[model samples]
Target chain A: MNVVIGIDIGGTKTKIGLVDEKGKCHIKTFFRTREFPDLDDYLDKIKSVSDELVENLDKKVTILGCGIGAPNASSKKGTIENASNLVWKGSVPILEKLKERMNIPMRIMNDASAAALGEMLFGGGKKMTDFIVITLGTGFGAGIVANGQLIDGYDGFAGELGHVDMTIGDGRLTGLGVRGGLEAYVSATGLKRTIMYMLSKYLVVSKFRGISYNDLHGEDITKAAEEGDIIAQRAFDYTAKMMAQALANFTAFTQPEAFILMGGLTNSGKWIMEPLESYFNEYLLEVYKGKVKLLESSMDGKTAAICGAAALIWENEKS
Target chain B: MNVVIGIDIGGTKTKIGLVDEKGKCHIKTFFRTREFPDLDDYLDKIKSVSDELVENLDKKVTILGCGIGAPNASSKKGTIENASNLVWKGSVPILEKLKERMNIPMRIMNDASAAALGEMLFGGGKKMTDFIVITLGTGFGAGIVANGQLIDGYDGFAGELGHVDMTIGDGRLTGLGVRGGLEAYVSATGLKRTIMYMLSKYLVVSKFRGISYNDLHGEDITKAAEEGDIIAQRAFDYTAKMMAQALANFTAFTQPEAFILMGGLTNSGKWIMEPLESYFNEYLLEVYKGKVKLLESSMDGKTAAICGAAALIWENEKS
Candidate 1:
């Protein structure tokens, strides 16, 4: 069996895994992504850890290449440009440096795009040629696939669905300082903001009454909603409605076969999915009613990112 | 010379022409589209007109095939589905019937999609592989090209940008009864409604004061705006702003190389284009500020439809 090394660089930690062609991870490890201030030092540590993992493998396998997924990574330029979350201050020549050190083929793309490719190959999107995978993490990110190929657009910035404006006036402000963007209403941070807004606007009694904004998390809201908290339920409803509306707009443009939901929001299960489905159907045009499917991603959250990175290599090879 | 027969099926009349490989229409003719209630009769009349045009061509040419562009046409199913503007009530097997009559290769696609193919091959989009063509006629229609290919999506209904909701409230109602859609604010009909809405909402005095809603047209507003009518100018401003916002949102999604404007709205020239360009810049994300170009279609409107319908066949042959 041939194997590829997959690296998923996150704000807090970097996950490294050896992924086989079958989309299975044989060994996985992690290191603090923000600990190293120097780019070369970080690459050295990553290479050492990957070498040790490869040495310990019980079965004989040919190491093909490496695939990396990171914030703001551009496959076209082979550099990570000004990723706000990462400690690296400027554009990092990741592909050039990695290839110089490992002497093998390597590729890089934004994490969201890599995840979409992973879903298409190994998860719920396996059978779908035209679908969008939306990652509802701290912020919203989208990977758009059309005609059985990922849409890289003109500048590899094509699938920025999170930045799409959703409101006309005084809507939630996004990190990008744009008011009423979809990311302001649909992400984990957006859900927390929605709950805060609901609490301030409505005098509904709930368990989250005393929770401070900084202390609140998406999991906390899920727990509270499960325990019959009205504020938390309202928060979920608002988020689902906004997401459904955005999805409806997206449907009219691309007419995808389905929309696959991933990341923290999907953890709420039926609480979010049910409302999302109903509102999406209501908001959709008559021509598209009951045609598009809403699906939950089959990839495991912990290893999904690593698998997605590795699948990039597999996808490139197949193409 | 090799030529192809192009047919553009409109609600009022059907335009048929003989087009050479270079996209030049040699001869053209038309007939009332609704005169025959039966689908076969309509197709037969179209065939007869096309045959007459082909026979009358002064140059010796090989008639390679036929291409049809109609509202709600499906290239995949070889049928024209329910078109609100057309007299046809259900799906019409146009490709089969036409192929049976002409006995060459035949293809059919929605009018907007055919127009997009035309633009890609011969109009403003001749050099652009990634761009969007917006048809601002009575209703809004869009054709998207990404990665050098048209996005037909899963059901051949992709690129429905007109129906994308632009507001969350009771904005202008669409012909489909959906309120606050992009079409409701940007199309010729939408512009009329905007002017009407502005007339009732604002006290700005202009030549439009005496015109009833039934008597108003897009050209009237254009003529008034050109003559320094504040009410007309405001209407143009409002329409351009909404269009710019929608285009910005679209940029975030597909990040096309340019956006080509066609039909009556583009006829306003700089009046619409200047404000549209400025507002589009203001609304676009920083990364995409000066990247996408806003262009006017070069194809003549009267013959553009025929050329677009013919281009579908030319495009298919090359692909």
Candidate 2:
């Protein structure tokens, strides 16, 4: 059996796992990402941890290589470039530094792109050659797989569906300073903003009227909507409408076989999925109607990142 | 030398040519497309024209195969399905019918998709592995190439950039009965409509003031803009703005190496190109700044369709 080390670098914590070819994680561990302020320190910790995991394995397995997924990572350059959430500034030559420590091959890519590979290798997109995976966490991210290959684009910055402008004018501004961006209204933060905006406008609102902006979360809104709260229900509807329109536009471009929704917001389940499917079909062109399927990601959230990172290495090896 | 028969089927006329592997047309001819309402009649005409062209070739050459470009073509099924512009009503089994007669291999794809392949093989996109070609004719059409392959999608309707809805409210209706589509604002017909709408709204106008809606043409607006007509300039500006925004949205998705503009509208030159490039950059995300290039198709308009059709066969052979 052959195994690969998978590392997922998040804003707060970094996950490490030993993943086999069958998409199974044999061992997993984590460390606080912020603790290592310097890039060299972080790389050293990763190497030590990986060595310990490899030494403990009883089976005679060859460790092939390492795959790392991080925010704003570039697969073309093997660098993490100007990621806002991370303490590192400028482009970090992650692959080169890791290569200096280990004689094995390595690969790096954007976290979302890795997740998309994970979906294709081990999750809902196994049979789908062309599809999109959208991650709705604190911010919105997307991964596009076309013709059974990930589209790294010319600069490895493709699949920024979250930054696609959806509003006509005077729309909400995203953290990226762009107004009317899909992420401003489709992510967990976007859902909260919608509920707050609705409460301010509609007098028919109920329990969410008094809640402060900081205190409200996506789960709160989902809970309220589940209990038949009109305002909460409307917020979910609004989010779904925006998402559907964006998906419609995406369908025109790539015409993927399916769209896999992942991360926190998907927990709302039927409330978001139902309207999303309806509006997506309604807004889609006549030819594209009933052709694309909307799906949910099947990877467990806690381990999905690691699986995706491992899958990246497996995908490269197979290709 | 090796040659292939290339046929470009249009609503009004059908272009036939004998093209070499180097993207040069040796002999070419045409016939009215709508004259033969029946599929069999049209196929017969195509066979005769192709045979005549092949017979007249001066140099000794081996005929490889045949490639056809038509509206609503499906490469997967080798059929043209529900093409509104064509006289044929339903699906036409173009490849099969032609193959049965010629005893040679043949392929068929949408006209726009053929154009993209042509650009890739012999025109502006020869060096590009990933790019999009937008054809701004009476109706808008697009063909996308990703990772050196045309994205035919699951249903062969992958590149429908023209039908992407741009307006939030009541927008100009397309022939497909859809409103606010990109085609409604960027094509020649769309340009004339914009000029007419401007004349109706703004009191300060020029030569176009006296012209009725039916008599006005896209060239009239281009001529007036050249002579310092404010309304015409604004119309051009408006069209560029809408096209730029749409291109920006497309950039976020495919992140193509460049966007190649073809057809009648591009003749406006810098009047359209300058603003398009400016606004495309403006709307693009910071990471994508100065990354994507906007270009004009270098192929002659009259010969491009034939070149594209021929290139399709070459692309198939090479792959």
TM-score of chain A considered alone, across all candidate predictions: 0.96, 0.95
DockQ category of candidate 1: medium
Local accuracy of candidate 2 as per-residue lDDT tens digits, A1-319: 7999999999889999999987888888999999999999999999999998888777767888898989888889999988878999988999999998987989998999999999999898899888999999988888888888888877788887787777666688987888888899999999999998888878895789778889998888889998889999999999999899888888888789999989999999998999999988999888788999999888888888898999988987777
How do the residues B143-218 of candidate 2 rate in per-residue lDDT, one tens digit apiece?
A: 9988887888877878888888887546898777678888889998889889888888899958888888789877
Candidate 1 segments exceeding 4 Å error? none
lDDT of 1 at B80: 85
Return the top candidate by TM-score. 1
TM-score computed on alpha carbons, candidate 2: 0.96
For each candidate in the order shown, give its overall lDDT on alpha carbons: 0.87, 0.87
Backbone steric clashes in candidate 1, count: 0
